[model samples]
Target: MSGGGAGASRSDARRNRALVLQAARSAFAEGGLVVTLEEIARRAGVGAGTVHRHFPSKERLFAAAVTDRIRLFADTAQDLSDVTEPGEVFFRFFASVARLATENRAVGEALETPELSAAGGAAGAGREFVAAFEVLLRRAQEAGAVRGDVVIEDVRTLLVGCLAMERRRVAAGDTTGVPGRMTALARDALRPGRTVTELPSAPRRRNSVECGVCGAPVAVARTGRPARYCGGACRQKAHRARRARAQGRNADAASAGRQRP
Candidate 1:
């Protein structure tokens, strides 16, 4: 009888915890991070003490929610890995995540915030998510369905940026089809044979942007110091060009001096 009672109690605890998590996710989505434990408990139909028992603080609770969502996404991606159509599976999962993030704006915001993202097992889950995502990306790349130049980080950035833009559209009262359009554009960008879209595009950067030597788009460093050249190769090339010009000018000056003498 005691064993059965213990089992039942554990089950109840698990159910209560899940309920609290679900309620907290909804509350955060609607009210941002300011939603109180009491409000979450009320929504979950549990007492505040129960919420506290499961999650010691609001940050922990939010962290748990973020990690839980990430794990679910990772699991889903793992399940889709065996599917024959790698490209389809990849884009479908991408679209699904964008839609999920769009619906749960709080999660999206949390993901964007570095401090919040690093809290409460979210980082661990992120590593796992990346591992799973890399599998899908690898399969697609091997199958020639996705461009070889793209990496897992690129996919993550693209999806997060899409969701962030969608959130901005909602905030600006232009929410219609933002998720869908952004996702479609992401899909198009990822397709094989398409020109790889560079990260931190023109809109996201400023300063003496274009590389003077290589003519490639130069990325503005986040730090105050901006990049002058695209890379080491360009810098070396420019150095050589300057040295050649200096030698030519010296030769011309010496020739003029000799003629005058």
Candidate 2:
């Protein structure tokens, strides 16, 4: 009947919208805004019209992806709140959040770009995450798993610092990773009578370099930190070309020396 047809259409619409969002999240995570809408449609196995109908523009799709991630974290926190191991759950949740934040390139891209705004739902999701986290913190404290003096604000700062340390390590080319260590350090501080690894010294600053191709100036951070090369992908391509040319010149020079001998 016509009534059943209308209901089926509504169900299909919801299904298509979910598909588009999933495709967008995966695509943006991999390639940021560089991934094309056509590619997302193909990934979702849906037509272009379905994607366009749900998200009229690529930016909107990106924003929606951000919103979806926020919701995911919030939902995860809510789910963990019910687990019986309240003491262990807090640290598990904390460590997982840190790991996810590192891999979440879309969120980083959104923060780096001024024009990319998150959808309205992101704010609400953030609030829900905070509330859920507070419950976890309280339960952990009640169970004597966490230090009584530690507050949610302290935990938030620790999480932020953990991410900052990770970026510094990456810039320094130390690939052993910082998050696990960061989580352990935080746990040592938060847990009752727990002693863990020593707190390491600050990360060393990398020396600022010329473009290594164009010899252009790189801007330093306002806090006196060394700056990475701007226009990175293009700069890297140019640097590789120069290296290739230099290698070719060295090979010819060796052949010439052999001929002279």
Candidate 3:
């Protein structure tokens, strides 16, 4: 191939890769890994073969997406490296990670890729993340802001658990900013303190609340109005009961009016 032709081809390939990566990020964030590569290709305005050429498997694509995020975090840590308040920098970074994970569900899912451990392991790119986080942790400890005993591994595990808890609350339909609250709790626990305080109880939900008619437990969605009845049958029954009560009230009022002056 001619030199100019080869350069054009390479440029096109790079553009396609960038598009695929962007589509993967948006798709996975909105729908998790359930979104197929074909959908991503369509979103990226590329062919299926292009996506396959760039990312051999779903696992690889997932890793690449997460690696991109981890690298960004590493960059952020570098920016905070010179800050005077080590503790504040560390905690603020922690909160930022949690907030982003909350906004992008894919981050939380990537952290808990139980099934993808073999094929979808986090990129060595995370090594940069680890090194960056170590600096933050070390600084915080030196400042006596964070607990001296805590290590990076502990912080990682805690972050994963915090994301899981946030997802659990969101799945249970807690509209409140559970991520911010949980991050605050984690910050409190990580501080150099005499005793590790127990976390507060999760916000109560009515998953156990009985159906208005069938007396069965109502299944609540993560968003929107809470369901009062178990299904259409129960809902219809409740509606009928309310209509009947209204009719009975009307009948009684009519009877009383006839007897009155």
Candidate 4:
């Protein structure tokens, strides 16, 4: 073929691939892995043959879609490397990721999906994303912005919890910046606080009175003397033990008197 024709063909191929990937990402985000290649091609305004040329299988396409998203997240986190305040940079990046995951439920779900470990570049991209976050977390810890005891796993768990809260808010039709609110809460929750003194105090135990006889937890009596026993059986047992002790003491005293000269 002519030089111009070859160059034009290459450009068209790149355009088609971009279109397919864009469509696949949207489709996967909306419909998950159930979206077919034909549907993706249709959405991309390309022929099924073009999609197949770019991605031979659905799994590869799905993996590519997820990996591309992960690459975006990793890149964003790394972009904050020049920021002076580690805490500010980390929280900003976390908010961005939380918003993305909240909006695209399938993307977050796929990241945590164990079966996706075998997917093409998806697993590798996920690892890269984790490494990037770990770097940020380490920086924050070193700066004393994050607790030393907190690890990447704690951040991951907190993010997941924030996403869950976002989901709940969405389901309740209250999606007015829920992601930001949740991320802020999560960031505070993840701050330095390993000891009880550093952490928020636990809620007071309410109406917790131990049983007099069994030593089991019992409800505190609102009225009358504060309940010592859980029930009548326990009260009776306590009474019998008290009586037995008193009788033994009295018998010992009587025996001592009789032996006296």
Tens-digit lDDT track of model 2 for 1-261: 999999999999999999989989998887778889999999999999889999889988888888766677778888888778889999988888766765676764653442474456655666677688877886786566876446676677677666666656666787664446755666668786773533333333486554332233466666875654545643565667689999999999999999994
Give each model a TM-score: 0.62, 0.52, 0.66, 0.62
lDDT per residue for candidate 4 within 1-261, as digits (tens), equals 699999999999999999999998899888778788999999999999999999989888888888878878878778876678988788788888888877775576765563553477777778788889988986775565776445687688788888888777777877465346766776786666533334333334675676644444578766887877766756776788799999999999999999999
Query: Cα RMSDs of all predictions?
Result: 11.8, 20.9, 21.4, 17.9
The regions of model 2 sitting more than 4 angstroms off are 1-19, 31-53, 56-59, 82-84, 107-120, 175-179, 192-261
Model 1: number of backbone collisions: 0
lDDT for each of the candidates? Answer: 0.78, 0.72, 0.76, 0.76
- lDDT of residue 259 for candidate 3: 100
Off by over 4 Å in 4: 1-15, 47-50, 114-121, 175-179, 193-261
Ranking by TM-score: 3, 4, 1, 2
Please identify model 1 stretches exceeding 4 Å from their true place.
1-19, 45-50, 114-124, 175-179, 196-261
Better of 1 and 2 by TM-score: 1
Which number leads on lDDT?
1
Candidate 3 ranges with C-alpha deviation above 4 Å: 1-7, 114-122, 175-179, 197-261
Superior candidate under lDDT, 1 versus 2: 1
